[model samples]
Target: MADLKGKSRATTTPADGCALCSLPLLVPQEPSSDIEDDEDEETPSHLIDDVELPCGDHFHWDCLMNASKISPVDKLRFCLFCRQQAVTIADDGSEKLLVHVRNEGGLTSNFDLGEEIRSEIAFDSNPHLRRTEAFLSLMSQDDLETAEEMLRGEDGAEPVDPNSTYEEGGLTALHVAAYNNNVRAIELLLRYGAQKDKRSNDGASPLDCASQVEAWNAVQVLNS
Candidate 1:
């Protein structure tokens, strides 16, 4: 009976899959003869451990490590499949995640661009707003080249105002760049006429936002 109960419990646990490779969760298998001579065939390390994404999916630790190597190191880590929050066990066993909340307008909820600024911009037909949103998204993704094109109106789109504030947070492109400590983005926005001292609805300047986020390089650049 005890053996049967143990088997039942083991069977009840959902099988985990590697979110990156879409393979069944597995430990590194012994190399077979066909690949044994291939020097490039490296063993995956997550055979003995795994991490859980925020959406409750599991992936091999080695898969995430490999993915990280080809992606921007500073960008937020997300699930390879779901594009949602992902987490790994810390050496100290604590969990860390970045959570962004959105409001009805599909913009970040916590910050506002102030009623005055919001009223001045025509939200309905503003191509600039759309471009700015795209630019900000690309910036968040660390897609610097595409973001630069968007900023420069290189795709025959209307030029975006680098200083334009988001209706939700009163955040300029500079604010976003500064918060992310993206020095290149900051320089680009400045070149495009982004104001250094423009404050959000919360009265926080981009530098202030950088300070709060501990973006030291942003703080230094904004100060200069």
Candidate 2:
């Protein structure tokens, strides 16, 4: 008998198309704790219904989590799926992320200025609310286009939250861009009228955030 994980919501899911991963396991894998004494595996935060990134590989929520467990190291790293850099182990289970920038066909040089502005204006309000740190890290890496795209909302006009807090301070998108030391992006935000002197909730300016990140170049851009 297949050990169904908890109570699956799908009663009549197809046999061949197993939802995400069409491949069926020879049998449903049981919880890891069933094989070993894992106290941490008691309450599974992820469930089958809760799976994100909708892959073809359908495993138990706990099973998927175990398979995706990329342990932390105190240095730079990348996630296999997203091919983006991993910043840190956030208090939440998700890893802080950066944008994946590849220099294929030299798209960076060919980017259209008009298109950039259009893209900025296409942002939707109420965009993804989490992953501020990862977004900031991506911006810092000079993947400005991808960073802006991620920051955009479904409508793609303005960020979901204009005044949304990115970090502890008043470091919003504008602040993170400036701290990232991208002069072009810094200038773009400033020209677009992003507030420079705006303080974080902690009263720290974007300049302060840049300083902490050791983004000396951004300091120069801001000062200029």
In candidate 2, what are the lDDT values of residues 1-224, reduced to their tens digit?
11223322332322342223444422343556556657776643322222222222223223333333332232214433443443444478544432211111111211122222222233322235334444556656777666566446333444533334654555776687766666777875665456778888878887888888989888887777
**What is the overall TM-score of model 1 with all chains considered together?**
0.43
lDDT of 1 by residue, 94-159 (tens): 544422222112212212112212322333347566677777777678787887787688989876
Clashing pairs in 1: 27-47, 111-169, 112-168, 113-170
Off by over 4 Å in 1: 1-124
* lDDT at 192, model 2: 44
Taking all chains together, each candidate's TM-score versus the true structure is 0.43, 0.36
Which structure among the candidates has the greatest lDDT? Answer: 1
* Clashes within 3 Å, all models in order: 4, 17
Model 1 / residue 193 / CA error / Å: 1.3
Q: Give all candidates' CA lDDT scores.
A: 0.61, 0.46
